[model samples]
Target: MNPRGTRLLAGRSLLVLFMAATAVPFLSLFTTALAPQGSTPHGISWPSHPHWHNFVDAFNAADLLPLLYSSCLIVLGVVPICLALCAAAGYGLAVLGFPGARLVFGLLLLGLTVPIESLITPLYYQMQSLGLLNTRWALILPLIGLFMPFGVFWMRTFFQSLPKELLEAASVDGAGPWAAFRRVHLPLAAPAVSSLAILLFLWTWNQFILSIAMIDDPSKRTAAGALGAFQGHYGTNVVLLSAGALLIMLPTIAVFVVFQRHFVKALLQGAVKG
Candidate 1:
Protein backbone atom coordinates (compact mmCIF):
# COMPACT_ATOMS: atom_id res chain seq x y z
CA MET A 1 0.00 0.00 0.00
CA ASN A 2 1.15 3.58 -0.64
CA PRO A 3 2.31 5.69 2.37
CA ARG A 4 -0.47 8.20 1.59
CA GLY A 5 -3.14 5.47 1.88
CA THR A 6 -1.70 4.33 5.27
CA ARG A 7 -1.68 7.96 6.50
CA LEU A 8 -5.32 8.44 5.45
CA LEU A 9 -6.42 5.28 7.27
CA ALA A 10 -4.52 6.28 10.44
CA GLY A 11 -6.09 9.76 10.42
CA ARG A 12 -9.59 8.30 10.02
CA SER A 13 -8.96 5.93 12.93
CA LEU A 14 -7.71 8.79 15.12
CA LEU A 15 -10.74 10.93 14.34
CA VAL A 16 -13.09 8.02 15.09
CA LEU A 17 -11.27 7.37 18.39
CA PHE A 18 -11.52 11.00 19.47
CA MET A 19 -15.22 11.28 18.66
CA ALA A 20 -16.00 8.03 20.50
CA ALA A 21 -14.04 9.08 23.59
CA THR A 22 -15.84 12.41 23.76
CA ALA A 23 -19.35 11.32 22.80
CA VAL A 24 -19.57 7.90 24.44
CA PRO A 25 -19.89 8.94 28.08
CA PHE A 26 -22.65 11.48 27.46
CA LEU A 27 -24.40 9.18 25.03
CA SER A 28 -24.13 6.29 27.48
CA LEU A 29 -25.55 8.35 30.34
CA PHE A 30 -28.40 9.53 28.15
CA THR A 31 -29.10 6.02 26.84
CA THR A 32 -29.00 4.61 30.36
CA ALA A 33 -31.47 7.23 31.50
CA LEU A 34 -33.82 6.16 28.74
CA ALA A 35 -33.12 2.45 29.03
CA PRO A 36 -35.33 0.07 30.94
CA GLN A 37 -33.72 0.01 34.41
CA GLY A 38 -32.50 -3.63 34.45
CA SER A 39 -31.77 -4.10 30.74
CA THR A 40 -28.08 -4.59 31.36
CA PRO A 41 -26.87 -5.99 34.67
CA HIS A 42 -24.97 -2.83 35.64
CA GLY A 43 -23.56 -1.30 32.47
CA ILE A 44 -25.06 1.76 30.71
CA SER A 45 -26.86 1.12 27.42
CA TRP A 46 -29.68 2.21 25.14
CA PRO A 47 -33.30 1.26 25.81
CA SER A 48 -35.01 -1.51 23.87
CA HIS A 49 -38.04 0.72 23.75
CA PRO A 50 -37.57 4.48 23.55
CA HIS A 51 -39.63 5.31 26.63
CA TRP A 52 -40.13 8.97 25.93
CA HIS A 53 -43.19 8.78 28.15
CA ASN A 54 -40.93 8.15 31.14
CA PHE A 55 -39.61 11.66 30.94
CA VAL A 56 -43.09 13.11 31.08
CA ASP A 57 -44.19 10.50 33.62
CA ALA A 58 -41.26 11.28 35.88
CA PHE A 59 -42.48 14.86 36.06
CA ASN A 60 -46.07 13.82 36.72
CA ALA A 61 -45.45 11.03 39.28
CA ALA A 62 -44.01 13.39 41.86
CA ASP A 63 -44.92 16.79 43.18
CA LEU A 64 -42.08 18.06 41.03
CA LEU A 65 -43.19 21.68 41.07
CA PRO A 66 -42.89 21.79 44.85
CA LEU A 67 -39.63 19.97 44.57
CA LEU A 68 -38.55 22.62 42.09
CA TYR A 69 -39.80 25.26 44.54
CA SER A 70 -37.76 23.69 47.31
CA SER A 71 -34.74 23.58 45.03
CA CYS A 72 -35.19 27.22 44.15
CA LEU A 73 -35.73 27.96 47.81
CA ILE A 74 -32.47 26.21 48.61
CA VAL A 75 -30.65 28.25 45.97
CA LEU A 76 -32.36 31.37 47.28
CA GLY A 77 -31.41 30.48 50.84
CA VAL A 78 -27.75 29.88 50.13
CA VAL A 79 -26.70 32.12 47.22
CA PRO A 80 -27.43 35.68 48.38
CA ILE A 81 -26.03 35.44 51.90
CA CYS A 82 -22.98 33.59 50.64
CA LEU A 83 -22.39 36.13 47.89
CA ALA A 84 -22.82 39.17 50.16
CA LEU A 85 -20.65 37.76 52.93
CA CYS A 86 -17.99 36.73 50.44
CA ALA A 87 -18.00 40.13 48.82
CA ALA A 88 -17.65 41.82 52.21
CA ALA A 89 -15.12 39.35 53.64
CA GLY A 90 -13.14 39.10 50.42
CA TYR A 91 -13.01 42.86 50.01
CA GLY A 92 -11.79 43.32 53.58
CA LEU A 93 -9.19 40.57 53.38
CA ALA A 94 -7.87 41.92 50.11
CA VAL A 95 -7.84 45.58 51.20
CA LEU A 96 -7.85 46.04 54.98
CA GLY A 97 -4.74 45.95 57.19
CA PHE A 98 -6.38 44.80 60.38
CA PRO A 99 -4.40 43.11 63.17
CA GLY A 100 -4.55 39.33 62.68
CA ALA A 101 -6.01 39.66 59.19
CA ARG A 102 -3.96 36.68 58.04
CA LEU A 103 -5.10 34.76 61.09
CA VAL A 104 -8.74 35.47 60.20
CA PHE A 105 -8.12 34.39 56.65
CA GLY A 106 -6.49 31.18 57.92
CA LEU A 107 -9.49 30.44 60.13
CA LEU A 108 -11.85 30.95 57.21
CA LEU A 109 -9.77 28.53 55.12
CA LEU A 110 -9.98 25.98 57.95
CA GLY A 111 -13.73 25.93 57.57
CA LEU A 112 -13.25 24.30 54.14
CA THR A 113 -11.65 21.19 55.65
CA VAL A 114 -14.65 20.59 57.90
CA PRO A 115 -16.76 18.29 55.75
CA ILE A 116 -20.53 18.80 55.49
CA GLU A 117 -21.22 15.13 56.35
CA SER A 118 -19.23 15.43 59.57
CA LEU A 119 -21.19 18.51 60.70
CA ILE A 120 -24.65 17.12 59.87
CA THR A 121 -25.39 15.61 63.28
CA PRO A 122 -24.48 18.70 65.24
CA LEU A 123 -26.22 20.94 62.68
CA TYR A 124 -29.36 18.84 62.94
CA TYR A 125 -29.44 19.36 66.70
CA GLN A 126 -28.91 23.08 66.31
CA MET A 127 -31.74 23.35 63.81
CA GLN A 128 -33.99 21.35 66.15
CA SER A 129 -33.22 23.76 68.97
CA LEU A 130 -34.29 26.67 66.84
CA GLY A 131 -37.40 24.75 65.72
CA LEU A 132 -36.38 25.32 62.13
CA LEU A 133 -36.30 21.75 60.88
CA ASN A 134 -38.81 20.87 58.12
CA THR A 135 -38.89 24.50 57.01
CA ARG A 136 -37.13 26.34 54.16
CA TRP A 137 -35.21 28.56 56.62
CA ALA A 138 -33.66 25.49 58.22
CA LEU A 139 -31.80 24.66 55.05
CA ILE A 140 -31.10 28.26 54.03
CA LEU A 141 -29.43 29.63 57.15
CA PRO A 142 -26.86 26.88 57.80
CA LEU A 143 -26.04 26.43 54.12
CA ILE A 144 -25.42 30.18 53.89
CA GLY A 145 -23.11 30.09 56.93
CA LEU A 146 -21.36 26.84 56.00
CA PHE A 147 -21.10 27.86 52.35
CA MET A 148 -19.58 31.22 53.37
CA PRO A 149 -16.24 29.70 54.28
CA PHE A 150 -15.54 28.57 50.69
CA GLY A 151 -17.07 31.71 49.25
CA VAL A 152 -14.69 33.88 51.28
CA PHE A 153 -11.70 31.78 50.31
CA TRP A 154 -12.60 31.76 46.59
CA MET A 155 -13.41 35.48 46.45
CA ARG A 156 -10.31 36.42 48.44
CA THR A 157 -8.00 34.62 46.00
CA PHE A 158 -9.77 36.26 43.06
CA PHE A 159 -9.91 39.66 44.77
CA GLN A 160 -6.25 39.67 45.84
CA SER A 161 -5.25 39.07 42.24
CA LEU A 162 -7.24 42.09 40.99
CA PRO A 163 -5.41 45.32 40.16
CA LYS A 164 -4.78 47.09 43.45
CA GLU A 165 -4.51 50.30 41.47
CA LEU A 166 -8.28 50.35 40.81
CA LEU A 167 -9.16 50.36 44.50
CA GLU A 168 -6.50 52.96 45.28
CA ALA A 169 -7.68 55.18 42.43
CA ALA A 170 -11.21 55.10 43.80
CA SER A 171 -9.91 56.01 47.25
CA VAL A 172 -8.01 58.94 45.76
CA ASP A 173 -11.26 60.25 44.23
CA GLY A 174 -12.77 60.65 47.76
CA ALA A 175 -14.94 57.52 47.58
CA GLY A 176 -15.50 55.86 50.94
CA PRO A 177 -14.48 52.22 51.46
CA TRP A 178 -18.05 51.01 50.96
CA ALA A 179 -18.55 53.37 48.03
CA ALA A 180 -15.39 52.19 46.28
CA PHE A 181 -16.53 48.57 46.56
CA ARG A 182 -19.99 49.42 45.27
CA ARG A 183 -18.75 51.67 42.48
CA VAL A 184 -15.51 50.04 41.37
CA HIS A 185 -14.46 46.70 42.81
CA LEU A 186 -17.69 44.82 42.17
CA PRO A 187 -17.86 45.71 38.48
CA LEU A 188 -14.36 44.38 37.89
CA ALA A 189 -14.99 41.38 40.10
CA ALA A 190 -18.16 40.62 38.16
CA PRO A 191 -16.55 37.72 36.36
CA ALA A 192 -15.25 36.08 39.54
CA VAL A 193 -18.49 36.64 41.45
CA SER A 194 -20.61 35.32 38.60
CA SER A 195 -18.43 32.22 38.32
CA LEU A 196 -18.57 31.76 42.07
CA ALA A 197 -22.35 32.14 41.98
CA ILE A 198 -22.61 29.40 39.34
CA LEU A 199 -20.62 26.92 41.45
CA LEU A 200 -22.49 27.71 44.66
CA PHE A 201 -25.88 27.68 42.97
CA LEU A 202 -25.21 24.21 41.50
CA TRP A 203 -24.05 22.94 44.89
CA THR A 204 -27.13 24.20 46.69
CA TRP A 205 -29.53 23.10 43.97
CA ASN A 206 -28.25 19.53 43.83
CA GLN A 207 -27.91 19.00 47.60
CA PHE A 208 -29.91 15.91 48.53
CA ILE A 209 -28.99 14.78 52.03
CA LEU A 210 -29.44 18.14 53.72
CA SER A 211 -32.72 18.78 51.95
CA ILE A 212 -33.87 15.24 52.76
CA ALA A 213 -32.86 15.39 56.42
CA MET A 214 -33.80 18.97 57.26
CA ILE A 215 -37.21 18.90 55.66
CA ASP A 216 -39.23 15.89 56.75
CA ASP A 217 -42.08 16.88 54.50
CA PRO A 218 -41.52 15.12 51.19
CA SER A 219 -42.89 18.11 49.32
CA LYS A 220 -40.17 20.28 50.83
CA ARG A 221 -37.51 18.56 48.76
CA THR A 222 -34.92 19.62 46.22
CA ALA A 223 -34.84 17.96 42.80
CA ALA A 224 -32.07 15.64 44.00
CA GLY A 225 -34.12 14.71 47.02
CA ALA A 226 -37.02 13.94 44.71
CA LEU A 227 -34.94 11.17 43.15
CA GLY A 228 -35.94 9.11 46.16
CA ALA A 229 -39.45 9.21 44.88
CA PHE A 230 -38.22 7.90 41.56
CA GLN A 231 -36.61 4.92 43.29
CA GLY A 232 -39.70 4.31 45.37
CA HIS A 233 -42.22 4.66 42.58
CA TYR A 234 -40.32 3.00 39.75
CA GLY A 235 -38.24 0.47 41.71
CA THR A 236 -37.19 -1.75 38.80
CA ASN A 237 -38.38 0.36 35.86
CA VAL A 238 -34.94 1.00 34.36
CA VAL A 239 -36.22 3.16 31.53
CA LEU A 240 -37.97 5.51 33.94
CA LEU A 241 -34.85 5.75 36.08
CA SER A 242 -32.76 6.69 33.07
CA ALA A 243 -35.26 9.34 32.01
CA GLY A 244 -35.42 10.70 35.54
CA ALA A 245 -31.65 11.09 35.63
CA LEU A 246 -31.79 13.02 32.37
CA LEU A 247 -34.65 15.15 33.73
CA ILE A 248 -32.69 15.94 36.88
CA MET A 249 -29.77 17.08 34.76
CA LEU A 250 -31.69 19.65 32.69
CA PRO A 251 -32.00 22.54 35.16
CA THR A 252 -28.29 22.46 35.92
CA ILE A 253 -27.61 22.39 32.18
CA ALA A 254 -29.73 25.53 31.73
CA VAL A 255 -27.97 27.29 34.60
CA PHE A 256 -24.52 26.59 33.18
CA VAL A 257 -25.57 27.70 29.72
CA VAL A 258 -26.63 31.03 31.24
CA PHE A 259 -23.67 31.66 33.58
CA GLN A 260 -21.03 29.88 31.51
CA ARG A 261 -20.03 33.06 29.70
CA HIS A 262 -19.22 34.75 32.99
CA PHE A 263 -17.27 31.74 34.24
CA VAL A 264 -15.18 31.68 31.07
CA LYS A 265 -14.51 35.42 31.38
CA ALA A 266 -13.49 34.91 35.00
CA LEU A 267 -10.91 32.27 34.08
CA LEU A 268 -9.49 34.48 31.34
CA GLN A 269 -9.19 37.41 33.76
CA GLY A 270 -7.57 35.25 36.46
CA ALA A 271 -5.14 33.61 34.03
CA VAL A 272 -4.01 36.92 32.53
CA LYS A 273 -3.51 38.50 35.95
CA GLY A 274 -1.55 35.52 37.25
Candidate 2:
Protein backbone atom coordinates (compact mmCIF):
# COMPACT_ATOMS: atom_id res chain seq x y z
CA MET A 1 0.00 0.00 0.00
CA ASN A 2 1.08 3.61 -0.53
CA PRO A 3 2.00 5.74 2.50
CA ARG A 4 -1.32 7.61 2.36
CA GLY A 5 -3.31 4.35 2.24
CA THR A 6 -1.25 2.97 5.16
CA ARG A 7 -1.95 6.12 7.19
CA LEU A 8 -5.67 5.98 6.35
CA LEU A 9 -5.84 2.34 7.46
CA ALA A 10 -4.09 3.23 10.71
CA GLY A 11 -6.51 6.11 11.34
CA ARG A 12 -9.56 3.90 10.67
CA SER A 13 -8.19 1.24 13.02
CA LEU A 14 -7.65 3.85 15.73
CA LEU A 15 -11.20 5.17 15.34
CA VAL A 16 -12.70 1.68 15.58
CA LEU A 17 -10.64 0.96 18.68
CA PHE A 18 -11.67 4.24 20.23
CA MET A 19 -15.33 3.62 19.50
CA ALA A 20 -15.17 0.11 20.95
CA ALA A 21 -13.51 1.30 24.12
CA THR A 22 -16.15 3.99 24.62
CA ALA A 23 -19.06 1.60 23.96
CA VAL A 24 -17.89 -1.08 26.41
CA PRO A 25 -18.98 0.66 29.60
CA PHE A 26 -22.38 1.57 28.19
CA LEU A 27 -22.90 -1.98 26.95
CA SER A 28 -21.94 -3.29 30.38
CA LEU A 29 -24.30 -0.84 32.08
CA PHE A 30 -27.20 -1.90 29.86
CA THR A 31 -26.55 -5.58 30.49
CA THR A 32 -26.18 -5.04 34.20
CA ALA A 33 -29.36 -2.98 34.34
CA LEU A 34 -31.21 -5.95 32.85
CA ALA A 35 -30.01 -8.23 35.63
CA PRO A 36 -32.62 -9.37 38.14
CA GLN A 37 -33.43 -6.97 40.92
CA GLY A 38 -31.34 -7.52 44.08
CA SER A 39 -28.83 -9.59 42.08
CA THR A 40 -25.28 -8.26 42.01
CA PRO A 41 -23.96 -7.74 38.52
CA HIS A 42 -20.61 -9.42 38.03
CA GLY A 43 -18.80 -7.66 35.20
CA ILE A 44 -20.52 -7.58 31.78
CA SER A 45 -22.22 -10.94 32.12
CA TRP A 46 -25.73 -11.22 30.72
CA PRO A 47 -28.52 -12.44 32.95
CA SER A 48 -30.25 -15.78 32.29
CA HIS A 49 -33.46 -13.79 32.29
CA PRO A 50 -33.31 -10.06 31.60
CA HIS A 51 -35.65 -7.95 33.72
CA TRP A 52 -36.37 -4.77 31.83
CA HIS A 53 -38.76 -3.67 34.57
CA ASN A 54 -35.80 -2.76 36.74
CA PHE A 55 -36.03 0.70 35.15
CA VAL A 56 -39.63 1.00 36.28
CA ASP A 57 -38.76 -0.25 39.75
CA ALA A 58 -35.83 2.11 39.92
CA PHE A 59 -38.03 5.01 38.86
CA ASN A 60 -40.63 4.26 41.52
CA ALA A 61 -38.09 3.51 44.25
CA ALA A 62 -36.08 6.65 43.63
CA ASP A 63 -39.17 8.86 43.35
CA LEU A 64 -37.51 10.19 40.22
CA LEU A 65 -40.46 12.28 39.02
CA PRO A 66 -39.74 15.10 41.41
CA LEU A 67 -36.06 14.95 40.56
CA LEU A 68 -36.88 15.11 36.86
CA TYR A 69 -39.20 18.02 37.44
CA SER A 70 -36.55 19.90 39.39
CA SER A 71 -33.97 19.30 36.69
CA CYS A 72 -36.32 20.53 33.99
CA LEU A 73 -37.18 23.58 36.08
CA ILE A 74 -33.54 24.47 36.53
CA VAL A 75 -32.73 23.90 32.87
CA LEU A 76 -35.68 26.03 31.80
CA GLY A 77 -34.62 28.72 34.22
CA VAL A 78 -30.94 28.77 33.28
CA VAL A 79 -30.53 28.11 29.55
CA PRO A 80 -32.54 30.91 27.93
CA ILE A 81 -31.47 33.68 30.28
CA CYS A 82 -27.87 32.56 30.14
CA LEU A 83 -27.94 32.33 26.34
CA ALA A 84 -29.42 35.80 25.93
CA LEU A 85 -26.97 37.42 28.31
CA CYS A 86 -24.03 35.57 26.79
CA ALA A 87 -25.07 36.45 23.23
CA ALA A 88 -25.35 40.13 24.15
CA ALA A 89 -22.03 40.08 25.99
CA GLY A 90 -20.35 38.26 23.12
CA TYR A 91 -21.64 40.74 20.56
CA GLY A 92 -20.53 43.70 22.64
CA LEU A 93 -17.08 42.25 23.16
CA ALA A 94 -16.53 41.11 19.57
CA VAL A 95 -18.27 43.82 17.57
CA LEU A 96 -18.88 47.01 19.59
CA GLY A 97 -15.34 47.65 20.90
CA PHE A 98 -16.27 49.89 23.81
CA PRO A 99 -13.77 51.39 26.31
CA GLY A 100 -12.59 48.98 29.06
CA ALA A 101 -13.99 46.13 26.97
CA ARG A 102 -10.64 44.32 27.08
CA LEU A 103 -10.58 44.61 30.88
CA VAL A 104 -14.08 43.20 31.13
CA PHE A 105 -13.25 40.42 28.68
CA GLY A 106 -10.13 39.66 30.72
CA LEU A 107 -12.28 39.15 33.81
CA LEU A 108 -14.48 36.77 31.83
CA LEU A 109 -11.37 34.85 30.78
CA LEU A 110 -10.30 34.75 34.43
CA GLY A 111 -13.67 33.22 35.28
CA LEU A 112 -12.90 30.22 33.03
CA THR A 113 -9.85 29.37 35.19
CA VAL A 114 -11.58 29.53 38.56
CA PRO A 115 -12.59 26.09 39.82
CA ILE A 116 -16.12 25.37 40.96
CA GLU A 117 -14.91 23.67 44.13
CA SER A 118 -13.28 26.91 45.20
CA LEU A 119 -16.42 28.91 44.57
CA ILE A 120 -18.87 26.60 46.39
CA THR A 121 -18.04 27.71 49.90
CA PRO A 122 -18.21 31.43 49.15
CA LEU A 123 -21.30 30.86 47.02
CA TYR A 124 -23.00 28.97 49.80
CA TYR A 125 -22.36 31.82 52.19
CA GLN A 126 -23.47 34.40 49.68
CA MET A 127 -26.68 32.50 48.96
CA GLN A 128 -27.33 32.10 52.65
CA SER A 129 -26.88 35.83 53.17
CA LEU A 130 -29.42 36.46 50.48
CA GLY A 131 -31.75 33.87 52.07
CA LEU A 132 -31.73 31.98 48.81
CA LEU A 133 -30.13 28.75 49.97
CA ASN A 134 -32.28 25.62 50.13
CA THR A 135 -34.50 26.89 47.30
CA ARG A 136 -34.50 26.25 43.54
CA TRP A 137 -33.35 29.85 43.22
CA ALA A 138 -30.15 28.75 44.95
CA LEU A 139 -29.44 26.30 42.15
CA ILE A 140 -30.69 28.54 39.33
CA LEU A 141 -28.87 31.70 40.39
CA PRO A 142 -25.46 30.16 41.08
CA LEU A 143 -25.58 28.07 37.92
CA ILE A 144 -26.23 31.09 35.73
CA GLY A 145 -23.21 32.80 37.24
CA LEU A 146 -21.09 29.67 36.94
CA PHE A 147 -22.00 29.12 33.29
CA MET A 148 -21.48 32.74 32.22
CA PRO A 149 -17.75 32.62 31.50
CA PHE A 150 -17.88 29.63 29.19
CA GLY A 151 -21.14 30.65 27.56
CA VAL A 152 -19.88 34.15 26.89
CA PHE A 153 -16.60 32.80 25.63
CA TRP A 154 -18.31 30.39 23.23
CA MET A 155 -20.68 32.99 21.78
CA ARG A 156 -18.02 35.71 21.64
CA THR A 157 -15.68 33.45 19.67
CA PHE A 158 -18.45 32.70 17.19
CA PHE A 159 -19.38 36.37 16.92
CA GLN A 160 -15.75 37.23 16.23
CA SER A 161 -15.71 34.74 13.38
CA LEU A 162 -18.79 36.23 11.72
CA PRO A 163 -18.11 38.32 8.63
CA LYS A 164 -18.14 42.07 9.23
CA GLU A 165 -19.84 42.63 5.88
CA LEU A 166 -23.19 41.49 7.28
CA LEU A 167 -23.07 44.12 10.03
CA GLU A 168 -21.85 46.76 7.59
CA ALA A 169 -24.67 46.00 5.13
CA ALA A 170 -27.17 46.29 7.97
CA SER A 171 -25.68 49.66 8.91
CA VAL A 172 -25.85 50.94 5.33
CA ASP A 173 -29.56 50.14 5.44
CA GLY A 174 -29.85 52.48 8.52
CA ALA A 175 -30.11 49.60 10.97
CA GLY A 176 -28.80 49.93 14.53
CA PRO A 177 -26.93 47.20 16.40
CA TRP A 178 -30.11 45.73 17.86
CA ALA A 179 -31.89 45.65 14.52
CA ALA A 180 -28.86 44.21 12.81
CA PHE A 181 -28.51 41.47 15.41
CA ARG A 182 -32.19 40.61 15.25
CA ARG A 183 -32.49 40.62 11.46
CA VAL A 184 -29.09 39.48 10.19
CA HIS A 185 -26.76 38.06 12.81
CA LEU A 186 -29.30 36.17 14.90
CA PRO A 187 -30.44 33.97 12.03
CA LEU A 188 -26.87 33.24 11.02
CA ALA A 189 -26.01 32.39 14.62
CA ALA A 190 -28.49 29.51 14.86
CA PRO A 191 -25.90 26.76 14.76
CA ALA A 192 -23.57 28.35 17.32
CA VAL A 193 -26.47 29.16 19.62
CA SER A 194 -27.90 25.67 19.27
CA SER A 195 -24.53 24.20 20.16
CA LEU A 196 -24.31 26.42 23.23
CA ALA A 197 -27.85 25.46 24.22
CA ILE A 198 -27.04 21.77 24.00
CA LEU A 199 -23.94 22.22 26.16
CA LEU A 200 -25.80 24.31 28.72
CA PHE A 201 -28.60 21.75 28.83
CA LEU A 202 -26.14 18.91 29.36
CA TRP A 203 -24.19 20.74 32.05
CA THR A 204 -27.31 21.94 33.84
CA TRP A 205 -28.81 18.46 33.79
CA ASN A 206 -25.68 16.82 35.18
CA GLN A 207 -24.87 19.46 37.77
CA PHE A 208 -24.51 17.54 41.02
CA ILE A 209 -22.29 19.43 43.42
CA LEU A 210 -24.16 22.69 43.31
CA SER A 211 -27.60 21.09 43.41
CA ILE A 212 -26.73 18.88 46.37
CA ALA A 213 -24.80 21.59 48.17
CA MET A 214 -27.16 24.50 47.60
CA ILE A 215 -30.50 22.75 48.06
CA ASP A 216 -31.26 20.90 51.26
CA ASP A 217 -34.34 19.12 49.95
CA PRO A 218 -33.57 16.12 47.80
CA SER A 219 -36.83 16.54 45.93
CA LYS A 220 -35.85 20.05 44.89
CA ARG A 221 -32.41 19.04 43.64
CA THR A 222 -31.53 18.03 40.08
CA ALA A 223 -31.97 14.46 38.84
CA ALA A 224 -28.24 13.75 39.07
CA GLY A 225 -28.02 15.48 42.44
CA ALA A 226 -30.93 13.51 43.87
CA LEU A 227 -29.28 10.31 42.62
CA GLY A 228 -26.75 10.49 45.44
CA ALA A 229 -29.48 10.10 48.02
CA PHE A 230 -31.23 7.54 45.85
CA GLN A 231 -28.03 5.54 45.72
CA GLY A 232 -27.63 5.80 49.45
CA HIS A 233 -31.14 4.46 49.96
CA TYR A 234 -30.74 1.68 47.39
CA GLY A 235 -27.01 1.09 47.59
CA THR A 236 -27.38 -2.64 47.97
CA ASN A 237 -29.28 -3.12 44.68
CA VAL A 238 -26.81 -2.81 41.84
CA VAL A 239 -29.38 -3.58 39.15
CA LEU A 240 -31.74 -0.88 40.30
CA LEU A 241 -28.93 1.62 40.67
CA SER A 242 -27.64 0.88 37.20
CA ALA A 243 -31.09 1.25 35.72
CA GLY A 244 -31.65 4.50 37.57
CA ALA A 245 -28.31 5.83 36.42
CA LEU A 246 -29.17 5.14 32.80
CA LEU A 247 -32.55 6.75 33.29
CA ILE A 248 -30.91 9.88 34.63
CA MET A 249 -28.60 9.98 31.64
CA LEU A 250 -31.31 9.43 28.99
CA PRO A 251 -32.15 13.10 28.34
CA THR A 252 -28.59 14.17 27.71
CA ILE A 253 -27.94 11.22 25.46
CA ALA A 254 -31.09 11.93 23.47
CA VAL A 255 -30.23 15.60 23.06
CA PHE A 256 -26.73 14.78 21.83
CA VAL A 257 -27.92 12.18 19.35
CA VAL A 258 -30.47 14.61 17.96
CA PHE A 259 -28.18 17.63 17.57
CA GLN A 260 -24.86 15.88 17.02
CA ARG A 261 -24.52 17.20 13.47
CA HIS A 262 -25.04 20.78 14.55
CA PHE A 263 -22.69 20.25 17.46
CA VAL A 264 -19.94 18.88 15.22
CA LYS A 265 -20.43 21.63 12.66
CA ALA A 266 -20.23 24.29 15.37
CA LEU A 267 -17.00 22.84 16.72
CA LEU A 268 -15.39 22.51 13.31
CA GLN A 269 -16.49 25.95 12.18
CA GLY A 270 -15.36 27.55 15.42
CA ALA A 271 -11.96 25.88 15.24
CA VAL A 272 -11.47 26.76 11.57
CA LYS A 273 -12.83 30.31 11.50
CA GLY A 274 -12.52 31.57 15.07
Pick by lDDT: which candidate is best? 2
Per residue, candidate 1 scores C-alpha lDDT tens digits across 1-274 of 8999999999999999998997787677677666544564255555567766667877777657777877887788789888989988988987764688899989988998998988889889999999999988888888887888888877777778877888789889999889988888888788888888998988887887877778888777678877876678876776666667667778998999888998898888882243
lDDT of 2 by residue, 82-115 (tens): 9999988988898887999899999999999999
> Which 10 consecutive positions of candidate 1 have the poorest summed lDDT?
36-45
Clashing pairs in 2: none
Segments in model 2 whose C-alpha atoms lie over 4 Å from true places = 271-273
Q: Report lDDT (Cα) of residue 265, candidate 2.
A: 86
Query: In candidate 1, how many Å is residue 200 off?
Result: 1.0
- Could you tell me every candidate's TM-score relative to the true structure? 0.85, 0.96
**Could you tell me the TM-score of candidate 2?**
0.96
Q: After superposition, how far is residue 189 of candidate 1 from its true place, in Å?
A: 0.4
